[model samples]
Target: MRRLHTRTARRRVVGALTAGLLCTFGPAAPALAAPAPTVAAPAAADVAPTVDDGLALTPPMGFNNWNSTHCRAEFNEDMVKGIADIFVEKGLKDAGYQYVNLDDCWALQSRDANGKLVPDPVRFPNGIKAVADYVHSRGLKLGIYTSAGTKTCNEAGFPGALGHEYSDAQQFADWGVDYLKYDNCNNQGVDARLRYTTMRDALLAATGTTGRPIVYSLCEWGQNKPWEWASDVGHLWRTTGDISDNWGSMLSILKQNLPLAQYAGPGHWNDPDMLEVGNGGMTDTEYRSHFSMWSIMAAPLLIGSDLRDASDATFDILGNKEVIAVDQDPLGKQGTVLSSEGGRWVVAKEMKDGSRTVALFNETGSAQRVATTARAAGLPAAGAYTVRDLWQHKSYNTAGTISATVPAHGTVLVRVSTDAKWAKNPPAVELGLDGGLLVEAGKPVKLTSTVTDLGRTAAAQVSVKLSGPAGWAVKATSPAGTHTLPTGRSLRTTWQVTAPKGTPADSYDLTLKASYRSPTGVRAENVLPLTASVVVAPPAGVSSLGDLPWLSTTNGWGPVERNTSNGENEAGDGNPMTVNGVVYAKGLGVHADSSVEYYTGKACETVTAQVGVDDEEGDDGSVAFEIWADGTKMAASGVLSNAQAAQAISADVRGAQTVRLVVTDGGDGSTSDHGDWADAQLTC
Candidate 1:
């Protein structure tokens, strides 16, 4: 399934190459399937109990060492103990985190002559029991990993507990192991349920002797529909495959886990793999969204970053107690989707206190206002409801409407309840732009930001200010401050913003902040951030777009390549840019959900390109290409497959300041969706 034990650089490269080869399957089916209909819940008496070991009543919150160190030498007993120490010192333990879990590669290649597992001396010199005792001393639990197959997933092929389930379980019990993350790898054709159940019985028998319950985590990669049968076998079963630390990977896992809410409850969960919060593969905003969605789905909160050297931003995200509370709610209910349309999603989870935590998520490339009423979020009717913004840690009283302008790949999480104390914090303000604004470098543009008071109270000292990066100029054309902003009233402020000449092409944050005082004299503030891209005008004559630098780019795999086809899932691994037996000298090669933008300076007329699934994918891959001018879709290539010829695209870009080349997985998951823009040209 997911092998992460390559010790050498060459082996890592080979692993990437092998993944690329595996992606060369037949064309994927249409991606646009109807969303799963929400199923009504059964009565408490009708529901069957799950692995009732009294462990992991909520999804496990802990640290797993697989995502950061893999099989590196740095992953030793000292590192594990250090993680435990950090858990306590850094307030993670106080934040409800436990279990210092170790993944594979901690065991020896072969068992001893007594048929007992042996810890790697280099990795655990004092042995597994010593590490467990140390973690226990720190008031945390200890978890160890092994596969159900004859060997583990790592390249070293460490001994597994397949035929030795009882013996291994007893050994773990003797070592005071508190959790067992049993994986599926080289399973020897055994049935998943049978194998996992064997471990379940073994653990139970072992607990009979030691009187210590071990939380069982089943990591089978969802190949066998574990959620349908894993409830009685393990505490948490992986609902999808392994997760990588990227936006696309996280989004894919979220999609896979969102619809399986009915299968989760007390003592059992549908895990979408571990958290990649500080893995460095995604931006902080995206990581926040990742953590938010997982908490909404009630998945495990196992930290996957190296705690020994994590950033403060990462800790801030992981340490968000409000978000963690949603995951650890005593009700043990997974969130159900309220609505999801056009990359905007609203999900709500019911808490033990009769409150609902609603998440407004934006999955598109631009900021959009996502809205849902309190009723839609399953909140009861009241005179007014306290809307607690979990991310901003602000509270406001809302009559019914709950909305926010969410940034691209961002989430606005709020808890709706009748709690009166929440009403004392502030008033809710909705922020938005008059329309999409795209400006050329060195050019001044007037943009209007609308601030609407959606709360029950009027706001005094209301002021709106727009700010950009250094070297950029911003001046408000309207009044900078007002005496009072009544409820349901909106105040508009226009600001003239100018990007400095020769500004590099990149996406910059332009924040619109509104500050006011509530009726109770509480200082309330709201900030909405949107991206402003600085674009470069095309040359005087027609030129290959690949020859020009882009404002920004996002690819599903590897780095977007210039003048080459997307090769293996690594940088500089692309082949010659080719499609349908035709080779082009210049263009971009990218994966699905990829977008590359360039400034046109409102001078370019027509943008033309030959687009299709890259020939490297053979007869596989399905994708659609679109040309976007400013914020409008100028042209689109309806779902094209690698089996088809290249499709020509020509979009009118007259009076457009920026142009974007976009590739999407054709209504399906982004598997083998290698797309190319061959001979892309911009006519100025």
Candidate 2:
């Protein structure tokens, strides 16, 4: 029960790491049970025209219930209807939102006697068709979810469209379904493109009396390189794993999706997952960035929140017509990063109407001021241009140079167009790095990047350098040596980056500085900061944890200290209760709820950690420490009052996972209950 039913696995599978910073557990990676079927290649001849149903020509816009009300369990029909009502009654339709997509778990435990998928009667007594009628009546489209495999991602308690693709497609079209979000899960060993096209064929073959055109959305989580071949198969395709509502995850998705812009155009888009605005994980600034970036990417603007109870801020952010217009821009050209400096990004898109859309994005921790000339952003630099902040709904004047101080994780989205219709030639050279952003703590990963000249002019003296965590032994071939790149040419370079022996499971930024000279002999630089997340998996057998930069992302009262004594933790300082070795937790009075997280490479039969009060305990208080695994508290040190002896707490962590060590003040007003989780070790 400590699995999918409780937590959502948005990252890697269960027995693997329910990653994305410990979201939850899923089934172990599915096995290839048998020889894969000799699936035929995609029907190149028919695939294009079959799904090119003149629909979703501008990136399907809607609200999907899967991300927010995952199986609301009670009255799923009303839930969807409420959103559809909100879309029309609240002006969302006017803003170009047109779809209200429903997800899995809306199915019954059993299909009809004829093996037809049925809506769970208790959840949708009126049936899905009734809800579809309502949504369509409001001039909106209706989308439903299913899986290409045997079951849905949630292993939903119902059959998917795998074996009954024709029947399900017929039923969906008959019921007026307009969109289909096909997930990949529980598939035996069928090739992804094969399975998805099977359903695509199923939907296309459904004609006659129940025949209706449906937009196809492939949600295979991008592991299969969908962009390489999903051109005519679906209206949109997911380009990465799911997105969590946090600054780190959102920024990571932005970086991942930036390079996939080429695959998006008129009939199809590269979805970066759903929007998490007003979800309360990050600040409004971060949500603004998320919304702006998604719009810039031309991604499907699917709201992942309950609109019935949406805050005014959420409503405004989602209903921002100006930003939505940029996403719905008829030009259909997806935005790409124009230039990057550290964590700041300048994204630009060419509009079909001779105008250009630009966004100054900052993902740093504080406000940063970045500047660029109009020519650098591909705009005509003849005279002053009109710049309007889509989020602020205000206009500003800028002549050639456009500058703004953007808050951390915030965006300055604007449209820059002057009277002169001549836009500057594009950048002469662009730099891109390809490698696994997530690195194993002690392993080394070689990175490769390609420098291309997209403009007509040639570039010379091209050079590239990398800056990462100090002393990671990061080395790269000196692209910095003088070199010439002709127009339409590209140069590739490799960099070998090795993580330190004792790196922690956290995200690190690696900044790439690439400089070149234009045809006119002017120098230009593009700073691309790549985020490398380190996963420190516990080694085999039993081993002592080594020294790492231990800082808590969420602060409680005190800090998790190492061999050095923690003096100021308590009022007088200087008493880190290190029991047997180097690691422990210390706190201040009246509080101290801190936790330490680690990744064990393999399954561990047992884990042990010593707990004790700080050696400098002065008053009467109780300290309680606990060890948690798979979302369950496995062991505890009850309530220790004295600081003399260390108590041993052990837990059976039979699988490789993220183990958490938590220390608290025993529920009472923390007096001198400075607690410590000392010398934690794992036995595999």
Candidate 3:
């Protein structure tokens, strides 16, 4: 959450005056308030509805006009109709998608003379109601966009439900809107929860009066936990910021929603905003991964692209019935990361059929073999399993456990069932680390192992043993198999080792052995070696100030400054200045001004400085100093004006040891013409 702060109007007046007086004023301005916090309404009453109620409708799937459509020249009725027709013609509707959502930038600037909200006359000449009717005629739902704040992002944007919640809600209902995607922008200084609830209450009131069940879609961008409260006020809340048409953005949004699974149900769900699955910026493999992740997350399947002309690959991905089933599972238990190793990630979802759906996801740039055993997914015990590849629609009967080679940024989803019998086969165990081969000693290391039975019916017994040097000991363990071993069958363990008094510093190898019985009652063993070590070193000193590396120049507006070959120069103009080794400034201008220069052979671990300024004209003249690390500001001095000179301002640089300084000109239009600083210093 971002903090709230007050901006002084005087600074703007001064800057304007200075700009007018000297046509040479540069592009330097004080940092403004951070972006506002986004919040959603309170949770809905915890009453579970029947499967027949609207609440039980299949997680509303549809194409959203945000990622791709936002870049268009306009969002008019033709565009909506074209997208809707494509939804049906492309077999998307058959795949269970029923909505065509229009995101921001579709509204007029004001209300009609009759106090009705109006659509842009030029783009949406027939108004939103006509658009909704057209979409309805195509057997799909229509969603409109609005902001929870004062204005929408489009031109002719009307002040939405902010302050006039009831009026706005009534207008939306009258407009025959089926879905209302309430956004958050321009509504600064308002409590997030209150901001969302204000609109929710108004919408609910209007819904009741108008005899409509407008599916309220909260779009606060997850400033707070909307999954916890959206069900009470809206159907779904975006769990992340608006997604872009790129794999990185999609993956980031998906990863952020993994922790909110427990909040999803039949009607209510976690929304990773919308889908960029078909966007051109991502590869085909990435698109598949996107679909798989979204399905497992129980996120609303809202596609944000030009579906009217999608590629065949897009259709195949979106139409994967087996994968979609996991998303629409009646149990509604969202999947979470069980383990991640060597670019291989294992995620599991509990199904209503007393089984589990596991996905082996390979996020690496290259394809990798990913395997999982029943124990890793919290199954009853190791046993031969009937596994079906959801994507390939293939069934394989052989197994000690389930495993597959996943494609780069791809996933292999399988439904594991024990009740159904299979031919007898030997049990097997595979071991690996979650993060990497290298790990810090004494910390808990998560080991992922899969135990599987060749014959799906027989239970497999499993045990594990750890062997290392005499001084090393296993601290704790979590067993995943049915029977705990003298060592343990768990995937995680902590190790502690103490070297002898005169022992030489070195690395040691430890062997982990896992043994298990196959469904056929056959015994098998697997061994894996892990390495650990300790290094001894002496303390070091900050030889010289030039040895500290500052912030990188790439971070244009960041606090730290880069150093030149021999030593960077430091000035006290638009940039910051370091006095006594301390960097200080009011606002460090990115361009010329007051600045500091330092050379760092290598980046320092930390830097410290004292900053402050004297007030020459009492309350009129104030000074400020700021510390920057690699162009990023680490700290700044509070405005200090009308004080004595030699006042101290301070800041600590944590990561980047070397930095520059910024001094700003502050104070009333009187005594002090600029700010000053003293006693600056950088420490290790």
- Which candidate number would show the highest TM-score if scored against the true structure? 1
TM-score of each: 0.87, 0.61, 0.57
- Report lDDT (Cα) of residue 633, candidate 1: 93
lDDT of every predicted structure (CA atoms): 0.82, 0.67, 0.57
Model 3 TM-score relative to the real fold: 0.57
By summed lDDT, the worst window of 10 consecutive residues in model 1 runs over 21-30
Candidate 3, residues 491-597: lDDT per residue as tens digits?
44433334444444455666666576655566655555555443322124443332333222211112222221101113221334432234544222221123453
Q: List pairs with backbone clashes in candidate 2.
A: 538-600, 538-601, 567-573, 567-574, 603-656
Q: Model 2 over residues 179-255: C-alpha lDDT tens digits?
A: 99887665555677878888877777664335578889988777677888887788888886666555545665677
Off by more than 4 A, model 2: 1-50, 207-211, 420-684
- Candidate 3 segments exceeding 4 Å error: 1-58, 154-158, 341-343, 398-400, 419-684
Residue 445 displacement (Å), model 2: 44
Q: Which residue pairs clash in candidate 1? A: 31-667, 31-668, 32-667
Put down candidate 1 lDDT per residue, 633-673, tens digits, no spaces.
98999999988888899999999877889898786556568
